[model samples]
Target: MVAALLPRERLLMGPGPSTVPNRILRALAAPTLGHLDPQYIGYMDETCELMRQVFQTTNQLTFPVSGTGMAGMETILVNLIEPGDEVIVMINGVFGGRMKDNMERCGATVHAVEIPWGQSFTLDQIRQAVADHPQAVMLGIVHAETSTGAFQDLSGIGELLHQQGMLFAVDAVTSMGGHDLQVDAWGIDAIYSGTQKCLSCPPGLSPVSFSPLALEKIESRTTKSRSWYLDVSMLKNYYTGGGGRAYHHTAPINMVYALREALAIVVEEGLQPRFERHREMHQLLRSGLEELGLEYIPDHSLHTLNCVAVPDGVDEAAIRKRLLNEFDIEIGGGLGVFAGKAWRIGLMGESASEKNVLTMLAALKKCLGD
Candidate 1:
């Protein structure tokens, strides 16, 4: 028989699933409530409200999907896109590539605009893509590319797309609470994010929001969404129907409690201050890494997730293993083209702290034999 499981605690400074605060852990341990329980409904409503505040949008379709961030991505794509529909996707990193894959799987005609892995798309590039693909229904991009630490600007792109009569979708999995995202002001038609990154919650739920225009497109779709589990029309009935809530699936009771607590923590600290904290911590980490003769990968780096180039002749895998086994600090390795050449050190949510920054710098210095 297996004994009671005991996992060693490590400081999580990785690409995602940042350190969960003790308060959130306590919330996760709260008594399990029925999926349709009146009390749980109250908590559910409050969670949606908190998510809207964090997303800075009044989208009525905003709620936490009962899966990871990828689920949220699929939810938006499948619901908004039908077979043969034209969509333009910006591919600068792994997540953007995944978006293109998902869009293709949805039977949509995807026009992938490729760029270098560690770079971001300029507004002119996006305009060119839109100009070339005049029939596209939506344009998707990643606000924070976790794999490469590229931060894409959404400032004028929304208005540009709106003028072209196209929907704007964003993958905000790594930027939700760590950066300043104005969904309404930016005119993002559809957006998806995870609770694990800047929210400091465990990896289970995905927070998503869809604008009225996106919902209108979904409503006007000729075919049903390929994914029944991710169909927003059905989900809206359960999350924000007219009368009594209809049972969809067994909601993740403890996880919702944890998300509520996490969002509450974010609200208490205030979004602007929290964003500033991540920026300051990233600068602190960047200065230390630069002193150690390291370089960054992205031209426009993300404050939440930092991807830095590893030094030549150093065994990156060995250093990562040593940091995990000896120092009990968990950082992430790179993905795609950056594999074996870069390290992704995340300053996300509760993990973004002065203490953690100093600790990581000291551990890495020792690992590098300096």
Candidate 2:
């Protein structure tokens, strides 16, 4: 006979699904309501407003897509991309490669500007890409690459693309709720972010937003989006405010509850303070690692996610295993090119705490026999 489900509490210091707070978990346990129930609909509206505040945008199209971060990416791509369109994809790490794949699947002719996985792209490289791909209608960039912990600066890139009449898309899956993401100020036309990272929520819903320019392009698309489930044109009808509702799909009722509460907590704490907390925790971890003779993978890394080189002569997987089994802690091994050669540590949401950082340092010292 199958036993009851009981999962141990492991301190999540990995890339995502960061430590969820008890308040958010309790919100998820609240009785499931009909997807379109008035109370639930009100909750959805509030969540959208909260998302706008978190993203620093006044875009009315902001709402949580009922899936993981990848779904949000596909939603933006399928709604904006069609056959024969030229899109410049900036590939600095695994998530950027995923964007390329998504673009190709949408029948977009992709022009990729790639750099070393652990570094941000140079301005010259970006300029060259746009100059070479003169017909490109869109530029896709990953803001926080969890795989490499490299942070891309969209501060000026948005204005650069806007001047050329190109739509700007961003994957903030790992940066949202943790980093300083200014969707409007950065001129990001279409952006997607996950709640699991810095929102102190379990992985499920992905918050997405589209600027007016992006919505105009979607409205002008001649062909249907390849993905019916992720079609923003269809989703907008149900998600946009003060509209007659059309049932698209049954919303992830409980996940919405969790996200609503999580976003509320973020609002209570304020964005600047949350971002500062993540940065300070990252600094604490960085200093601790440096004292242990460890080096960061990237010269400029993300405050929410940190990548560090695995010590030579040490078994990387074994170390992670020990960190898990012996210390009841959880961290991540690297991905793609850096796999088995590095570790991906996350200081996200509730996990980005001074106590957590100190505990991780103490545990690692013990495991490393220091």
Give model 1's TM-score versus the native structure. Answer: 0.99
lDDT digits (tens) for residues 1-370 of candidate 1: 9899887788999998898889999999999999888999899999999999999999999999999999999999999999999999999999999999999999999999999999999999999999999899999999999999999999999999999999999999999999999999999999999999999999999999999999999989889999888888788988986446777778899999999999999999999999999999999999999999999999999999999998999989999999999999999998999999999999999999999999999999999984
Candidate 2 TM-score, true structure as reference:
0.98
Badly placed stretches (over 4 Å) of model 2 are: none
Give the clashing residue pairs of candidate 2, or none.
Answer: none
Q: For residues 1-370, what per-residue lDDT tens digits would candidate 2 score against the true structure?
A: 9998999888999998898889999999999999889898899999999999999999999999989999999999999999989999999999999999999999999999888899998767787888898789999999999999998878888888988899999999989988999999999999999989999798988999999999999999999999999988888888884358788999999999999999999989999999898888988999999998889998689999989999989888988899999988889998999999999989999999999999999998888873
The CA lDDT of each predicted structure is 0.95, 0.92
Segments in model 1 whose C-alpha atoms lie over 4 Å from true places: none
How high is the lDDT of residue 176 in model 2?
Answer: 91
TM agreement with the true structure for every prediction: 0.99, 0.98
